[model samples]
Target: MSIITTATALLADIAVETDRTDAVQAFVKQETILVQITTADGLQGTGYAYTIGTGGTSVLSLLQEHLLPLLVGEDARNVEALWQRLFATTRATTTGAITSLALAAVDTAVWDLRCKRAGEPLWRLAGGHRREVPVYDTEGGWLHLGTDDLVKSALAAQQAGWAGVKIKVGKPHVFEDAERLRAVREAVGPSLHIMTDANQSQTISSALQLAAALEPYDPYWLEEPMPADDLSGHARLARSTRIPVAVGESMYSIMQFRNYLEAGAASIVQVDAARIGGITPWLKVAHMAESHNVMVCPHFLMELHVSLVAAVPNGKFVEYIPQLRAVTRSEMTVRDGVALAPDEPGIGIDWDMDAIDNRRVS
Candidate 1:
C-alpha cells in the first residue's frame, strides 16, 4: 500500500472569490494546479496548489517540465526522499520560490493519498492536538474597499461570531492609515482581538512610526509591517515597538523561520502552505515555531489550515478571508468564534467541480 506509480497532473481553472470592493484592494484571480495520484489499490487522492495572478501557467510549466518526471514511479510514501530529490535536482535551474512552490503541489497530493488510504483525517494522522482553532475573520484591505467599507466589514465579521479581525494599513500617508485603524478598532469594540497587516507594504521608519501611532488601540500583532525578507529590519522594529511583530507568508523554508526566530523578527509566525512547499515543510516550521515559543498563525488555505493549527500546541488564530467559501463545495463552519476541523479522511477538501469548470481558462 504505497504510492509507487506515477500519474498525470490535472490543471484546473479555479475562480476563487475575494470580498474586496474597488476601494480596499483589487480582487485576485487564481490559476489552481490540482494534482491527481492513483494508488495501486485504485484509490485516488487529490491535492491542490494555486499560483495567483499571471505567473500560474509558468509555475505549472515548471512542475511539468522539471518536477513531474522525477516523481513518475517513486514511492509516494517516501515523501522526504522525493522532496529531497526534487530540491537537489532543481538546485541549478531554480532553487527557491519557483521550485519550492512546485514541490508544494507534489507533496500535498502525496499527503492526500496517504491520508485517504489510512481512512483518517489529516489532523488525526498528523497527531490531533486540538479539536477546533479560534478564527479571526481577516478583512479590511483590498485597495478597493474604502475606509468606510472597511469599517462595515469589520463590524460584519464581529456580528458573525469571529473572535478577531484583521485590517489592512500602509496607506500613502501615515495619519490616514492611523485613522482607518482607529475606525475599525472602534467598530470591533474593546473585547475582540484586532490585528493589522501591511502585506509587506511599508518602509522601516514608516512601520515603526505606524506601530507607535496605533499602540493606543492595542493590536494583537502588527503583521508584515515591512517586507518578509528584512529580518534584521523586522527585528529592529520589534525591539522598538511594543506591538508584537507578526511575520511569515513570505518565508519559504525552515531556515527562514529559524532566522526569524533567532532574530526575534516576529512574535507570531504565519505560514502559507502553497508558499512554503506544502504540509511537510509547514509542519517543520510549526514545530520549530512551537519550540521557540512563537505563535503559529497560518495564512490562507483556511480549510487545510484548520487541521494544521489543530495539530499544533502553539497554534494561534487561523486567518479567515472567506474567498474560498463561495467556491469550495464544503465551506468552513465557524461557530461562536471557533473554526471546527473536518472529521473526514484526508485533508477533507470537497472540491466544487462546477466552480473549477467555470473558472478554467485553458
Candidate 2:
C-alpha cells in the first residue's frame, strides 16, 4: 500500500498530573502539536509533540509550507528516503529543535502506519525483546516538591512498586537542593534508585558544588547540570562529579550525541523520542551509545520508549512522568516500577476521537 497520501495538524492542551507548576516550563497553558497522517488505503496514523507551547504552530508551518507538499502522494514506506528529503529540504538549518520536531511528527506517523499494517503493537514491531521496561516516577518529586512532598511522591512510587524516582535539583541555593535530595534518599533508602535533574539550571561551578554537596546521598545520575548544548561544559562537569552526567533531552541530532560521546560528556544518555527525529535516529543514538558502553535511559514518551528500550540490550530506565493520563484514550499499564509496552497496533494508542472532535480548533 502507498504511504502518506495526506497529513493534518492541530494544537492541543492536556493537563499534567502534578499541579506542580514550577517544575514544568512556564508556557504550560499553550497547546502543543498533534499530527495525523492518512495513507492511500485510507489507513491513518497519529502522533504528537509536547513542546512547551507554540511548538505546534511551528511544526504545522514547517510541514504545511515545506514538508507536506513533498510527502503527499509519496510512498510513506520510504521512511529513510523521506527523512533524507526532509532533512535536505531544511539543509540551511539542518536538524535542530524545530526541524526535528517536524520530523518527529512525520516519523511517528509512519511508524504508526507500519504497526497498523503489521497488526502489532509498536513494541512488537520494534522487536518486543522484553515485556517490561523499568520506570522511574518524575512527578513533581523535586526541590519544588518540598521535602515532605518529595518524601510523599517517593513513598508513593515505592508503594506502587516503582524501581526508582527522579528528584529535581536546581533551586536558588545549592545547599537547599542538597537537603531536599537528602530527604528523598532518607525516605527511599539506598536500594531504590534515585536520580537528580538540574534542568540546565546551574553554572558548571554551581553544578560541581551541588554534586559535591549531594554526593553523600548517592544519586543515580545527574541530568543537564548545564544546558544540553554545552558539551564541553558537561564534559568538565562529568570529570569533576562522580555522578554520571545525563544529557540529550535537548539534543536533536546524532552529531550532537556524538559530540557528547566523544567528549565523554555524559555517562547516561537520555534520548527523547520526539526530539531526536523520531524512532529512526533515536535507535541510531541507542546503538551508538551501546558501542560506547554508555547507558541509554530515554526521556519522556515512556510508552513509545518501552518498546525501544526493550529492543536494545544497553537500554536503561524510562522516565515516568504522569502527565498524559488525563487526555489519553487508554490508560498505560505500569505495574511495580516497570511499564509494559502497548500491544495494540500502530503506536498502540487510539486518540479519544470524541475528545479530539470536541477540542478541534475551528
Candidate 3:
C-alpha cells in the first residue's frame, strides 16, 4: 500500500469573463481551493473545490488545519475508508458548504490517485456506461440578458448542435419569464429541448404560476423554484406543475437527496460533485438516483462532471459552463450536441501550475 507522504492545499481566484446573474446572487469570481496528495511511491493525485466568490479561504483552512493532516501516512488506495474517516471526523460540519467543499478536494484527489494507479481513465473506472453525454447551454441564459438576446443565444446554441438551452427565470413578473421562454421556443422550434431555472428564487405559489405560464413552451424541466431546504414546497410544486421538477445543486448531503427523492420533490437530480463531497459520494448519489429511476444532470464543473455523467447509465446531461478553461490545459469537446469524456488516465483536467500559482491568494 502506498502511504500518503505529503498533503497540500492552496487557493486561487479566477474572474468570470462577463457579469453573470441569477435570481439569488451575482456570480462575481470563482475562489478555487486545490488539493494535492503525494504517496511514498512518488505518485500524486490532485483535486479541487470552489465557491462562487466567498468562503474559499475557509475551505482552504479546513483542508490544511483539519482534513489534510488525517491523510498523512494513511493508505492512498483506500479511498472509501478515508472518505468515511474524514466524514466522521468532520461531523460537526456534516451538513454545510465549507465542510463539504473541503472534503471534496481531499476525496477527489484520492480518486484521481486510485484511477492513475489502475491506469484507467476516470470514466471507465467510474463504470463506463457511455463515453459521450449530451450538453446544454447555461452560460447564455443569465437573467440579465434581454429576451431578444436570449432568443439569439438559444438559436446560436441550437445551430451549434447543443442538446438543449437553459434560460434563467425569476424575472420581476411571471409574464416576463414566460415571454422569454416563449420567444426562445418560437425561435428554436418544437424539437429543441428547453430548461428553466429560478435559482431558488420563488415562493411555491410563484413557482406554480411560472410553471403554468411556461407549460405551453414544453420546457424539459423547471429547476430550483424555491430554496433548497423546502422539500414539502418542492413536492407541492412538482405535483402541481406539468413541467418536470429538477433540483439538487444547492443540496449538501446524500440524505438531503434521499429526502427530495423519497418525497418526489425532484424528477431530475442536479447534484454538484464538489458540493456533495467529491466522486465517492457523487457516485453514491448517482447510483441512488438510478435505483429510483431518476436521471442525473449535474451542475457546473463540466470538465470534471462530463466524465462522471458519462460513467453511469442513468447520467443524462452535462451543463456547459467554461469557468475553468483559463487554469486548465484542455476544454471538453462537444461533438453533435454531446460532450465527450476525456480519455486521460485520471480526472480529465491538466492544471496549469503557473496559472494557478499566479492567481494563488493563500
Candidate 3 wrong stretches, greater than 4 Å: none
Q: Clash number for model 1?
A: 12
Write model 2 residue lDDT over 1-362, tens digit each, in one string.
66667888776666444544333344354354667889889999887666764566777788778876788877877778877888888977666788888888778887888788888887767766776888888874745556888888888888878888888887777888888888888888888888888788888788889889989999989888888768888989889888889998999899999889999997998998889988878889998998999989998777678778877878878788655555566766788678887777888665776676565554
From the highest lDDT down, the ranking of the candidates is 3, 2, 1
* Residues 26-98 of candidate 3: C-alpha lDDT, one tens digit per residue: 9989999999999999999999999999999999989889989999999998888999999999998889999
lDDT of 1 by residue, 12-96 (tens): 6555465443222444666677767776667777777776555677667888787788776677777788778887887775436
Which of the numbered candidates is closest to the native, going by highest TM-score? 3
If scored against the real structure, what TM-score would every candidate get?
Answer: 0.93, 0.94, 0.99
Which has the higher TM-score value, candidate number 1 or candidate number 2? Answer: 2
Candidate 3, residue 85: Cα displacement in angstroms equals: 0.5
Q: lDDT, candidate 1, residue 331? A: 80
lDDT of each: 0.78, 0.79, 0.93
- Candidate 2's C-alpha runs over 4 A off are 21-24
Query: In model 1, how large is the Cα lDDT of residue 58?
Result: 68
lDDT of 1: 0.78
The 10-residue segment with the lowest total lDDT in model 3: 322-331
